[model samples]
Target chain A: MIRTLLATIALALWQTAALAQTNHQHVSGSACGEAVLRCASKVTPAFAPDGTLWLAWLAGGQVSVASSKDGGQTLSAPVAVTKLPLNLDTGPDARPKIAIDRNGGIAVAFAIFKDKAFNGQVFATRSADGGKSFAEPRPITSSSESQRFETIGVDADGSVFAAWLDKRNRIRAQQSGRKYEGAGLFFASSKDGGATYAEARLASDNTCECCRLGLAFAGPGRPVVVFRNIFEGGVRDHAVVSFADPATAGEVRRVSNDDWRIAACPHHGPSLSISAAGTYHVTWYSNGKARKGLFYARSQDEGRTFSEPLALGRPDRNPARPYVLAGPRGTVMVWKEFDGERTAVNVTISHDEGRSWTKPVAVATTKDTSDHPLLVSDGHKAYLSWMTKADGYRLVPVGDEP
Target chain B: MKRRLLAAIFLLGSLVAAPGADTTSDFKLKPFGRGSWQEVLRAHAGRPTLVHFWGATCGPCKVELPLLGKFMKEHAGIEVVTISADLVPDLPGATRAMLEKAGLRPAENWIFSDGFVERLRFEIDPTWQGDIPRTLLIERDGTITTIEGSAEIPVLEQWSTRQRAAPK
Candidate 1:
């Protein structure tokens, strides 16, 4: 009986090894020709709070979203989430984003291209039935056009927060939808599952444009937004603010004081991941005159303040587009490094809070092509998604070992 | 008669003094102006005009434009042009000079002259919020056939070769 049990155990182990080496289908049919525009700025995929993957990309001058259930294996046909007409002037690299509610509903948002200018407007669509179908996209800001850099976040209670860098009331009046806004962060919310949103509120002001806005839910209905702020003398630094109800009211606060100074837009932004105990881990890219590095900081008391940012990458190669996600095992941070003509994705892991980090591993390779990578983690298994040099995309799974 | 002659001379002189008179009207392409976008598009009306909008600062556009030059040369009877939207003032006496250095000189070249920028915006797609190195393939009937931010050599070559072989 003991011999027979040993043989069965060996057989099981062999099966497990075989499955791990199994190759995952990396590329599907290319969205080429008129269906998908040819550009460096392409699709960005994220997982819904319900483990279903969602992809958002620009197609035919409009933003679109598609869903996948089998862990990025197969995708549903893309659906037009932006109701804006085909002639609406949308810009490149301003991808649409989606966040999932506690009940598994989804909220999607992106900017609009208008009037010989990218008069950036934020629009949101909701899927109450867990993405079976999405409700029509509705405008979240006033009709008076302004340049906006918008992002969305949903909490456990289904409250939604959409934040953007608004420039309607700035003194200098920067170019709409092109340059960094010289104003504060504006927000609108939906408590009834994104069916209706509150009037726009000023969360914070004096934020940079070109930098992306990030949002992470702290608790039942409270969420926080992290973005690069433009301080005095055109310094670009990272900042965070919280929403008391997130569904209503204008409760926003700045969380950090890096004070990095620069004259040009970095085209990089901050990313956030919230722990179960409401700890906020924010990572951003900074290259001031004094120093330049990828910095990471954490806030234990719900983003009241943050620890000093720990620089991860080397000085010679500045990392771009750093993404952080707090998984069940630990916090995962991923970024891309440009090496002359090639680009590579790097991932660093931390297990004991943000105290320590693992050796960074390369996830994807870009051999002489502009590869814009995006990452999404479902609190357990993290996936790295990026466009390849040959007009393709990849999804790399970084799961903790047993 | 003498007074009328003076008035006509004054009128012609004023028309020359008007801004954009040289470019906005009767802006013909010269022999040295190889790959001029306007002349090529006007000559090849009703056929697809493959325009490669390039810039000196853009790396991708640099590589893509040379391949386009060779491709246009190889495929006879195919009309292709490149618009060099280089800042005219920044490269004083250097606009045509740099085209030679960059090897972008083909049969018809058009450096977006002063005042032509606004006119092209209205002529083509008004909704075109200007992005650099933009590639536009307009069909024969003046309708935009394909519009994109960038193009690869293989894809463009294949598409143009196929169209060249197709029946008119």
Candidate 2:
């Protein structure tokens, strides 16, 4: 009577290189292939000062970057960031981050899993001679137990600011027999336009272990970072920290109280943008009792206080992975909505610095799996950078509502 | 007496290959695709089943998995199944190795075959927003009790004990 048929059981830490799988994604009629732009798991786009759109994508265990002059209509030949195929971190929240400085310097950062336990090492590479070639990628931190969900932002002075979720503190606590709730947030800045980075510094400890971080800039040396923070009761809610300067870690302030208290991974992280009016607009997904889906909030008082949480999409449709950007024309946010069959990328805009908004609309729709919808702008116009399996890469101009 | 001797030898032979070591051949890593959920339910139609979902990168899962194996050794009557949320052809060796190290012999293991993780996750549970260390327990009548986050061993043991004591 104890005969039970268990179905799918996966445990961790099996040592086998012989049967290690290399083919994760299938080639789609020459379109669903690997190691190319179209077959990327996640794609990130950044606009250069000269309006050249730069994209970095992870595919076939390698990171590649390409530039588009016509606003993603056509691209230059791709340059490989990683020489060898690595155990790249392919988490849903994982993506290569790219930033362009004022002098057209390209700085790229992405992560690779170092061990079977899913520990990650983030690598940074820079292109000084435009898009011709990139330097050898190096680890951002000297001590590398784990680092992930790294984000890159170009400060007003054209220096690169990098922030990521770090686990060095967790390892230290475990060694000292102290209980650490979650990972910590660490940051670094490159005064030399990302050629060489300064020493990595801790912004805050006990940050959420997983999920991505949202990075923005306030002024020349000021960088603002937003991520999931573990509260006193183990409630992993979102928080924002504004750096006084590149070296100083600012106070950790609650973005909103969704009260998502769980010891598991949400995979879904928050998105942030700082308007010219000095308002902090953030969007994140929470399954807490107070909030059950995607929500957007804005804080006019720096990162100190936020507005009431505004729900995003219909609960039945499953809105996820929202991205917010404050562009020159206006502020735009995009997220994915799955209605069982087709998945649509929806967009909402605010012309008055997030004080009001337009209704969310399906800017792009695909019947197949797609990367998270992201927005990129060139001061004059904003566009949606969406990559899908069925369709190739899409860069659609969303118009300037401002 | 001869049959009992062969069975005993076979059991010993399997145990010799099951501890502290694992290769792909040591365990079966099947495909848990879009429609495999229903097939799994049907396979254990009238029996109690435990299906676990984990990923190699999941921190809490690494802690909970080995403990689950120890629990399985104590309760031989309950079936334990696991599915990896991580895409196959990745670093899936750790999952197989961990399963073996935990002494979860005779385990039914599956991996996410499709690259579209969201759709696959939706099939298992629409409410699940891709959290690891999650589990689902199905009773004889196909009533599923979901244990979100890392499962508690005592809760699982009590549930299994309760099922055995229930009238069939």
Strongest candidate by DockQ: 2
lDDT of 1 by residue, A1-402 (tens): 332233223222322322211111011112332323232135677676667777776544455667778865676776666433232212223567777766677777766532212235566678777666777656666534454567777666567777777766563345444443355678877886765577777776677755678788877777788888876666667777776776443334454555565433344568888887678999886655544567788989777778877887655444666788887777888886654344678888888778788888887766533335666776567777776535455778863632
Model 1 stretches astray by more than 4 angstroms? A1-33, A36-40, A82-93, A128-133, A171-181, A247-258, A368-371, A389-391, A399-402, B1-168
Q: Give, for candidate 2 chain B, the lowest lDDT window spanning 10 residues.
A: B12-21
Q: Write the per-residue lDDT of candidate 2 for residues A108-181, one digit (tens) a residue.
A: 98887654556787778899999688887767766646899999888888888999989999999999999998
**DockQ versus reference, model 1:** 0.02
Q: What is the lDDT of residue A357 in candidate 1?
A: 87
Top lDDT model: 2
Regions of candidate 2 where Cα sits further than 4 Å from its true position: A1-34, A399-402, B1-22, B87-89
Error of 1 at B70 (Å): 38
Model 1: lDDT equals 0.58
The residue-by-residue lDDT of candidate 1 on B78-147, one tens digit each, is 6676665532111212334334544545546665543223224334433332334566766656655544
RMSD of each: 20.3, 10.0
DockQ of each: 0.02, 0.18
- lDDT of all predictions, in order shown? 0.58, 0.78
